[model samples]
Target chain A: MRATIIHKPGDIRIEDVPEPKILRPTDAIIRTAATCVCGSDLWDYRGINPVDEPHPMGHEYVGVVEEVGGEVTSVKPGQFVVGSFATSDNTCPNCRNGYQSSCVHREFMSTCQAEYIRVPTADGTLVATPDQPADDLIPSLLTLSDVMGTGWYAAVAAEVQPGSTVVVVGDGAVGLSGVIAAKELGAERVIAMSRHASRQKLATEFGATDIVTERGDEGIARVKELTGGIGADSVLECVGTQESMLQALRSTRPGGNVGFVGVPHGVAIDGQELFFSHVGLRGGPAPVRRFLPDLIDRVLDGRIDPGKVFDLTLPLDEVAEGYRAMDERRAIKALLRP
Target chain B: MRATIIHKPGDIRIEDVPEPKILRPTDAIIRTAATCVCGSDLWDYRGINPVDEPHPMGHEYVGVVEEVGGEVTSVKPGQFVVGSFATSDNTCPNCRNGYQSSCVHREFMSTCQAEYIRVPTADGTLVATPDQPADDLIPSLLTLSDVMGTGWYAAVAAEVQPGSTVVVVGDGAVGLSGVIAAKELGAERVIAMSRHASRQKLATEFGATDIVTERGDEGIARVKELTGGIGADSVLECVGTQESMLQALRSTRPGGNVGFVGVPHGVAIDGQELFFSHVGLRGGPAPVRRFLPDLIDRVLDGRIDPGKVFDLTLPLDEVAEGYRAMDERRAIKALLRP
Candidate 1:
């Protein structure tokens, strides 16, 4: 089976690797139907996150369950399924509290770019569609495995209400998806912060009522200008840099919330600054498993179409080009089919 | 009139200061009936928060309205009233959103240690009691101006819900007051992290179901053990140090919240650590004005006796001793009668 491997920074290869098998009683093996590149993957590819040795890549996927260990009763072989980047046992206190990404027996799914992958804690991590989804629906369904669900969590974490004014602080696929999530959650006004014309168009299609191309202080000022001089009711931080984080925090009104989904890198929030801001902050790896069921329904019902985020598609053999295109800012996201 | 002044760190004095007069049409003059030394005051007293020059001290007080400016109609002269240390117009966007402390027209009361003090935004900052209370209720009522209200904000910001398991990481008056708040908010188990015997006793009286004496890692571990190894639902961070902040964050379960109220002196939060912890963080100068009315009612109803935190009392003329007693930790808090 072919798998995506990163030998070092700026080095990605499609190498033939042994197919994954059910390694635990709670695991299930799935034949990959679709997988994609993520912004976080660039952390390693760009040498920002050191790569000590070559390793399997990818954590998002939608596939057909090829086999399941005895203990996995909720999902069975031959079922078309979607699973989160982080696997969970679901019954743990954290999982029960809607933080499945923090489940006590959690295992983050890697090597999903391979032809076949094993999903641990299958019962809790994988949600099967009602039936085999149409080929056109696969891209949207595949997103439920990570990005779309993550976007939904961002909205929920920010406590976006029916009358909320939301600001999305990223232009990547996740940010565009967040626009959809905010609108679905009944946000009356969704502002997408993007200078890229292509991403801006997609964000508008996904329900962004406005766009602020400014960055830093000017960006904060622009948001405040649009929000009656205070700021938005909620801000979804999809980019994890210090600048993006500050943008999200400062663009929210006093008593508002910043749901930061971007994994922070080198960001140190000043305690005194945050205290005086009076803005609530909650961020982490999105508990995608917790939102899979609801998001799947929304996708199936055609209430949302997040697949538009995938502008470039290629065969699994072209995984390297996919990474390059995304890293060089030529593509919002690249979808690879095995 | 006599007022408490801090000439420098460790140098507190009772000085003859001119009586306060309404400086704003929204101001009202109050004859101080009771005031107290707060834990935050010690920051200035200990040189942690620099006392640049001789300045008035005290922000907590219960008093009788001496006079009202032309625009101050909600409070009348001679009426007993309670006003938060952070005054608010209550009509601003932030105030309307229940973050009165961040109101557009906000002021911090700093002269309340004097015999007579002026309160700005009187209509919104001062809440009049239905009737004058007995002298015995003075201490508790005085706390509503700051400590008690701050504690309530901690609980509220921490999202202390019915049946929650709460951990309070401070034993000062505000933290002791937090124990009461957690109980009143329907927490099933309230853990007070305190090593002081006297404070532990007061915490127990205020409804702490358990006490953890450990600090740092041991404290986090003990709290985890008490909370079924997952951590508490809500952690109130009342002592604003880096250690206390980390303790509060580590002791809360994923999806739980940490509401920090102590004015942070030198604290910086690592974004990565906090992100992976999955704990929501919201802190600031307590929006005391938001919780003033309810806290006043709780004190007046005798349902909560936060006044018990005042283990020592002094006349306004001996205000230096009041500061010294609290600074030495010889008293939980000091109530000053003018």
Candidate 2:
């Protein structure tokens, strides 16, 4: 089967890989329907994260189960399902507490960006709909596996309450979707930081009440200005850079929260600053499993179309192009159909 | 009037100073009934935080209102009152949100070490009882002004839930009082890390269900072991060292909270680790104004006695002894009578 692999910085390739099969009692083999190049994928692609060797490329996917292990009861063969970026046993204490990303028995699903992928702990990791999803819903459903769930988690972690003034500090799919999440969660105002005109348009369409074109200090200043110098009630940090983290921290009002979904890189928080600000910090890898069910429901009800983030698409054989498009910032996200 | 002053590391002196008087329209002059040396005070005494020049020593106090400025309203002359370590204009947005320590118009009350201290923003900073408290309640009421309020803020910031497991990462008066706050807030289990036998006894008396004499890594491991391989649901960090902060982070379960009330020295948090752990971090200087009224009620009702933390007492002229006792670790906390 063909899969996306990174040989080194700026060198992603589509190559033949062994087909996946049920490896554990709770495993399920999925025939990939759609997968995408994620914002996080750019971290390794740009070599910011060392690519030690050729590694699997993506973690988001929507697919039909080709086979299921004897212990897999929740999902069966031929059933279409969406899985979280991090697979979990779901019964673990962490998963039970709705933090599946930190589940004791967890597995990254990056291998899912291929013709076939094996999902472990299938019964607890995969969420199947009542029936096969219609063909047209594939793109939107694919988003539920990661980007959508991640966005929702960011909003929830930020504690976006009714009448909240929310600031989203990334222009990628997750940040754009965060705007949607904040709106769905009842935020009175959503401010999206995006220099890209296209993303800004989508942000406004998705419910961003304001868009700040500046970055870093200027961005924070704009947010504070929009909030009457009090800063936003909640800040969603989607870009894991030090500047983004600091902006997120400074953009929140004293006693407000900064929910960071960005994978931090070279970001070190000064304890004194955090202490003096009294801003609550909480986030992490999104507990996508916890939000998958709700996100799928929203998709099915036509309440959100997160698939709009995918501005480009390609065949599995051209997966490298998908990575290139996102790496070069030509597209917000790229979809790969297998 | 006499006051305690830190001239240099290991050099504390009792010197005559001008008596305080109302300096602002919102100020109130209080004759100190009791003022105690705090853990933070030891920072300057030990020279971890430099004492550039002789500076007034204490920030915690309970006293009798000697005089009130023309604009003072909530507290008046001849009334028993407890004021926080930091005085805040309680009408600000931050204060309205219960983060009085970060109020737009906040004032530090470190000069309280003197025989007479002037409290700024008196109407918003001091909480008075219905009548003069009996002598027996003075010490406990004094505790409410800082240590107890700080402990309560730690517990509240950590979001201690009913029946949750709580771990307190310091054994100072604030940490010991945190055990009381945790129990009062309905924590099912409270673990206190204490090396001293006296502090251990006080912690246990304050409803600490477990005591671990270990520090840092081993201490966190012990807490995890005690929680059945999972960490505590809430951790109160009352010690501001890097090790204590990291230990507090590592001792909390994923999705749990770490409320820090310590005045940070040089603590730095690795964002990646904090991001991956999914633990919530919230804290800072205690918004004592928010907790003062409730704590006063508890002290007045005899429901709690925090005065036990004060093991040594001295006249204002002998304030140097109080500083030495606390600095030498001979007393958990010391009280000064003026």
Candidate 3:
């Protein structure tokens, strides 16, 4: 089978890889129906996060089960399923507590941008669609694997409610998805931090009531201005940087909640500042598998169109191009069809 | 009036000080009935947190209103009152959000260990007791100014509820208070991490179901072992050191909450580790004023005895001994009568 591998920074190639086989009794082998290049992937592609060696790429995918180990029961051959980038045994204490990403038996499912991928803990990690999704719905369903669930987690973590004033930091796919999540969760107002024309349009279309083109202190100032100088009740942080993290923290009112989904890089928070701020901080990997069922229902019910984030789609063999397009800001996200 | 002043580390002197008088329309002069040395106060006494010059000591107090400015309304002369260490207007956005400790118009009320002390924002900062009580209730009421309220804030911030297994990292007055607060809030099992036999005794008396004397990694191991390897549901961080903070974070299960009320010192948390931990962190200065009403009711009703933390009491002139007793760890806490 062919898969995407990064030899080093800015160097991605499609090469032949061993066909996936169920190695464990709880494993399932699936044929990739849809996959995508994630915003986080750019960390390695842009040389920010070290790509140690030639490693397989992609963690997001929606697929049909091609085969399953004898012990697998919940999912079977020919079933279309959506699974998160991280696999987990849902019965663990952490998983039961709704933090599947931190599951005791958790495993990162990489090399998913391939013809076939083996997923461990299949019964616990995969959520099957009610019916075979149409081709048009695959891209949207693919998002359920990561970005959509991640964005939803951010909103939920931030305690977004029916009348919450929300501020979403970042205008990428996840940030835009958070706007949708905030609206679905019934936020009264959502301000998206972005200066990009296209993402700003998508943010508004997805439920952002306002868009601020400022960064850093200016961005915080704008959010405070919109919130009557009190700051937002909930702020979603989607970019993992010191500036974005501080912006999210400062953009919230004392006793407010900051749901930070960004994978922090070089982010050092001052304990004194956080102490005085009184804002609650909570976020990490989205337990997407825990939320997959509800999110899939919403998608199937036509309440949200998260697939709109995929502005470009290419053949699996051209996965490198997908990365390139997103890296150069030519597309919000790139979908790969196998 | 006589007050306790810290001329340098280990040099606490009883000195004549000017009588406090109402300084603003919102101010009130209180005749100090009880004031206590706090764990934070020891920071300066130990010279870790510098005492630059001769400065009056003490921040926790419970007293009777001696006089009020023309505009003071909520509290008045001859009223027994319990107030937070910090004064707030109770009308700012932060105050309205239940974070009065960080109110925009905030003022730290120091020099409280004296015959008379001035309280700013009297109407919002002080809560009167139901009735004038005997000296027996004075100590407990005094804790509402800081320690007890701080412990309660830790529990509330950590989202402690019925059946929660709580871990308290510090065994100081605040940590001891947290045990009481956790029990009052209905935690099923309260764990106190303490090495001191006396402190451990108080912890169990205050509702700690278990005590683990280990620190750092070993302490985290004990907590996980007690919780079926899942970690505690909620952890209260009352010690602001880096080790305690990290221990509190590592001792909780993913998705669990860590409510920290310690004044942070040398606590630099790695963002990546915290992000991966998936534990929620919240807390700062306890919004004591917000919880004063309920805490006062509980103390008056004999439901809790937070004042037991004060193991020694001295007349106003012997205030220096109170500080020295606490500094020497000869007393868990020391109360001063004026």
Per-model TM-score versus the true fold: 0.99, 0.98, 0.98
Please provide, for model 2 over A1-338, each residue's C-alpha lDDT reduced to its tens digit, 9 standing for 90 to 100. 99888899899888898898777889999999999989998888888989998888889998999999988888889999999889999998999889999999998888877999889899888999878888878888998888888888899999999999999999999999899999999999999999999999999999999999998788878888999787888999999999999999999998999999989999999999999999999989999999888888989899998889989989988888888888888999999999
- Ranked by lDDT from best down, the candidates are 1, 3, 2
Clash counts for the predictions, in order? 0, 0, 0
Q: Per-residue lDDT for A1-338 in model 1, tens only?
A: 99999999999999998888778899999999999999899999999999999999999999999999999999998999999999999999999999999999998888988899999999999999989999999999988888998888889889999999999999998999999999999999999999999999999999999999999999999999999999999999999999999999999999999999999999999999999999999989999999999888998999999999999999999999999999999999999999
| Best lDDT among the predictions, by candidate number | 1
Worst 10 residues of 2 chain B by lDDT: B315-324
- Comparing 1 and 2 on lDDT, the stronger one: 1
Report the error of model 3 at residue B172, Å: 0.8
Candidate 3 error regions (>4 Å): none
TM-score of 1: 0.99
Residues A1-338, model 3: lDDT tens digits: 89999999999999998898889999999999999999999999999989888999999999999999999999999999999999999999899899999989999888898999999999999999978998888888999999999999999999999999999999999999999999999999999999999999999999999999999888888888899888999999999899999999999998999999999999888877888788899989999998999999999988999999999989999988999999999999999988
Worst 10 residues of 3 chain B by lDDT: B319-328
Interface RMSD of 1: 0.6
Q: How many clashes does the backbone of model 2 have?
A: 0
Q: Which stretches in model 2 have alpha-carbon errors above 4 Å?
A: none
Clashing pairs in 3: none
